[model samples]
Target: MIVVGAGPVGLTAALLLARRGHDVQVLERRTLPSELPRAVHLDAEAQRVLVDAGVDFAALSSPGAGLRLLDADHRVLAEFPREPGAAGMFHQPDLEEQLRAALARAGGQLTTGVGVVAVRPVRGGAQVVTDRSGDPVLAADLVLGCDGAGSTVARAVRPRYRELARPDRWYVVDLLAPAPLPVWPGVHQVCDPVRAATFMPVVGLRYRAEFRVTDQPLDLPAELARFGAQDCTVVREAEYEYGARVARRWRTGRVLLCGDAAHLTPPFIGQGLGLGLRDAHQLAWRVDAVLAGAHDALLDGFGRERAAHARALVRLAAFTGWLMTAGGVRAARVRSGLARLLPSTLLAAGTPPLRPGPWVRRPRVGRGHGVGRLVPDVRVRGRRLDDLLGPGWALLVCSTEVPDLPELPGGARARVLHRGALPDLGPALRDRWVLVRPDRVVAAVGPRAQR
Candidate 1:
């Protein structure tokens, strides 16, 4: 299999596929990994997906925290705790390094300094032509377009899909703060009539600021001054404002698209990267299953499931953008009234609040299947489920009479836990038998008698 793009989403998809024992090749145009911070947040769901892909979040830099919304004066309009299990402010470069390392450990092949010029479907496979030196043609049974918004693969599949146009434009500037500011660790948004600014603390004292420019031509110096900053050194800057858009179809024959190549959205909700990660996880499993002789119909579910999730995210992002960028007299009144009426906790309650910790354990049962799902990571009988599972199958025996059901065949491993031993298990595991997948999703839940 050939995957295009080496960003986090692309590398992640490659790693998952490689772990499933596929011969995966990752192609990228960049000669090296990026050093600048692009994305500022990773929600709980995305972090779980990374952990399941073999990433060690605990070992990375401490997560950035909380969300603070403010008006043009920098007065707090509302503050919300970042969702539980979400990553606050780690550098994008650092996160990408971790992902790249995981991909390496998983034995995936990564080709840098290579650009895919075009992709087309062939009999039982796809052919990709790249500008990398040496061989210009790469062949694989399947092609995955993980390339960003301007995706060549998506262009190739244009006849089968349509691209939606976004409505606005935004710019992001990453900086290395000479010193720490009084700003909170979480996200801070400063809203105004003509423009807005967003502050994100990456790691330590460094930070990233995103500015929404109303007019086409932007004055960087003036914008920086408006945000109450001066003499700040810029690390990177890029334009982002665009309305949400997605392909009509994700797959056309052996070639498919994932991540930004398949969809694009404003960063208002911070769901852009998270959605991309989900795309990787969803497609990886189905691709592996298909390669393993699973029915092709299983592949059909990828677009359906992802499209459902993406649509919701798109709407959420659009709503957030509209609220933050509201203008005119009525908008001003609405914004001011909301600022006065809501307390910080009430504003934040809509999203999961942040917790204090370097590593927050998620709840799980049995093994493999429960890892990715949201469960309190607690111990039963002095053993944490995460410690016991180690990326494998888990079996929870709630009944005294452990069913005479057959053990997992082949190399699969299983764990047995008594429901009576832990009171907490009563709620999450009511059934006598529960089977968890490697990623900690519940595969099967049932009574021992039924089994």
Candidate 2:
């Protein structure tokens, strides 16, 4: 299989597919990822996905803490915790570089400076036209496009699918601050009627500022001046708008769309890359299954499942963007009133809880919940969740007394956690045995003796 685009989503897909024993190639148009910070927020769910993909989180630099919502004057509106198992912030390139390094270690090949111009479906495969050193054609059983919104794969297949376009244009200016701002180590959002600004700390003494400037092109110097900074260098600038759309068909014969090639949404909830990561994980497994001679239906399930998820994220992002960028006097009044009336708890409630255990359950042995479902990640004795299972079936026995069930087969691993002792277990599993799947959903809840 050949994957197009060497961005985070594409590189992750390549690594996973390669680990599943496929010969995968990742193509990138750029020589390397931008040094500038982009998409700094990484949520709890995304971190779990990275762990599941065998990424060494410890190898990368630690991310900044929590998320903060503020008003135009930087007055705190809401604050959310940023635990290791919860959401945090990191520079996009740093994370992407780590992913790329992992992909290289997993035997995935990356071809930089390769620009794919067209993709055409062929008999039982796909053909790609590209310009690396020169115009050349490459053939593969499947072509996975992870390119950004202006995807060459999307353009090539545009005539074969329906497209949705948004109405308003939004501009974003990314600036690098030489010194750290006198703020907490978290994300800050300043909402105003005419403009909005989001500040996220990427690393020590350096920060990323995302400005949502509408109506006119942003003057980087002028904008920086308004923020009390002098002579700041502009790193990146782009125009974007929120929209909800997906390829009518993910797989046309053998050519498929993944990541941004398949869908694009605003970063309101910071799910833009998160959803793409989900696509990589889900599609990698199904593609591997198909290659291993599993039912073709599994391959078809990719589009069916991901399309629904993509649409939901797009709508949610659009709604969130509307709330943050609301205009008019009435809108401003409503926004201010909301800021004054809404409790911090209510705002925090909007953020998902950190449920890590249910996420690691095996689907075949234990009941599988949908992706992003909350699950506990408690350890049994000295065995950590990362060690108990090896990408297969696992049983989590949380009981004071051993159950009467038969021993697990060679392919399955089991863990017995004494009641009221496992960390992060809370007071819920005091003396009950819970059966968990690899996907981390509780399959069965019963007395300890039931096993």
Candidate 3:
């Protein structure tokens, strides 16, 4: 297997593939991880994936509290408190460095300074074409494109890049805190129509502020002063145009697209990187299943499920962008009122329920709606639910006896975790169990478990 563009997503895919006993090679253009700070957030789902991949977040970042909406004057309009989980605010370099190390430890080969021009499907598998002339074309059983927006591999597939929102520009600046500055300990969306912006305390000594700005250059000092960040020293600043977009297709033949190669989203809600990590997780496991002698239809199911998820998230980001920067002061006041009315679940960061496909069970089955969604990372006997399942498909029964294995994948009658240690698999439900996929997604609800 070959993974291109060894960013976090690519590294994660390679790591997972190698852990599945496959020969994996990761190719990257840069010899080392970039120090420039870009994405600075991740949710529990991403953290769960990283933990499965053997990346430690304790030394990289820490989770924080609160997601607040503020006026231009920095007055709190509405607030939603957040809880600490496996995820946290982290710098890009720290994450990539750890992922790279984990990939290496997983026995995946990483070849840096190599550029792939394109990938094509051959007779039995895929071939990777490189920029270097006279080099042999590399053949692989499978190829994954983790390349970014201008993905050459994705271009090879000739899929339409559907633009979901009008292109917009933003000036993002990362500042160094001279000391442990007494700043607000959470993310703040400055929902001012005239000057919409976001401010957050990044991990380490870093602070970042992004303003929805014109395409032209701006006086950095003045902008910092306006944002009341003049005291901090600038570490990095750049102008980037961002918007909501997703690929019309994710897979073509043996070459598949993941991460930014499949979708693009504005930074409004900080889901950009988390989406990619989730894509990598989904892609890795399904490919593993196919290679393990399962039917090839599992691969298509992976693409379908992921593309739907990516589209839903991009739409959410677009809607969130509207909520943060649309309308006048009167409209802002209305938003504040509406925010207060909003449920915490709506504001929390999590994946939407998947449609019925492959392992995803139909919804409205009794009272259990967990199918097609990630199983909660509940601790059973001091071990995470993920730790109990390990890296393969399993039957997670909350009952005394494990059920029959009709829903289990081919020859993969793996572990069974029962309620003896679970303590709580929903006290209200009777005769409940869940078939968990390798990605920890609830694949099916047990018989008679649904209402």
- Candidate 3: regions farther than 4 A off: 215-219, 226-228, 363-365, 398-400, 427-431, 447-451
Among all windows of ten consecutive residues in candidate 2, which has the lowest summed lDDT? Answer: 353-362
lDDT of 1 by residue, 1-451 (tens): 9999988899888888888788999999999898867766676567767777888765654564666778767777766675544454467778889988888888999989899999988977899999966889988998989998889888776724333334676788887767776667677777676567787777776777887767656677876665544567888888865758766788877788888888877777777787898788767766765776655565666676566567656766776666776676567557856755444432232233122111112334442322223344457568655556555556667666655544442335566766556545435455446655454545455533343
- Best by the lDDT measure: 3
Backbone clash pairs in model 2 (N, Cα, C under 3 Å; residues 3+ apart or in different chains), count:
14
Misplaced by over 4 Å in model 1 are 132-134, 159-166, 216-228, 339-397, 400-439, 442-451
Each prediction's RMSD to truth: 6.4, 5.5, 2.3
Model 2 regions lying over 4 Å from their true place? 58-64, 132-135, 155-168, 216-232, 340-374, 379-387, 393-451
Worst 10 residues of 3 by lDDT: 422-431
Clashing pairs in 3: 365-450, 366-450, 366-451
Which candidate, 1 or 2, has the higher lDDT?
1
TM-score against truth, every candidate: 0.81, 0.78, 0.94
Total clashing pairs in model 1:
24
Q: Which model is ahead, 1 or 3, in terms of lDDT?
A: 3
What's the CA RMSD of model 2 in angstroms? 5.5
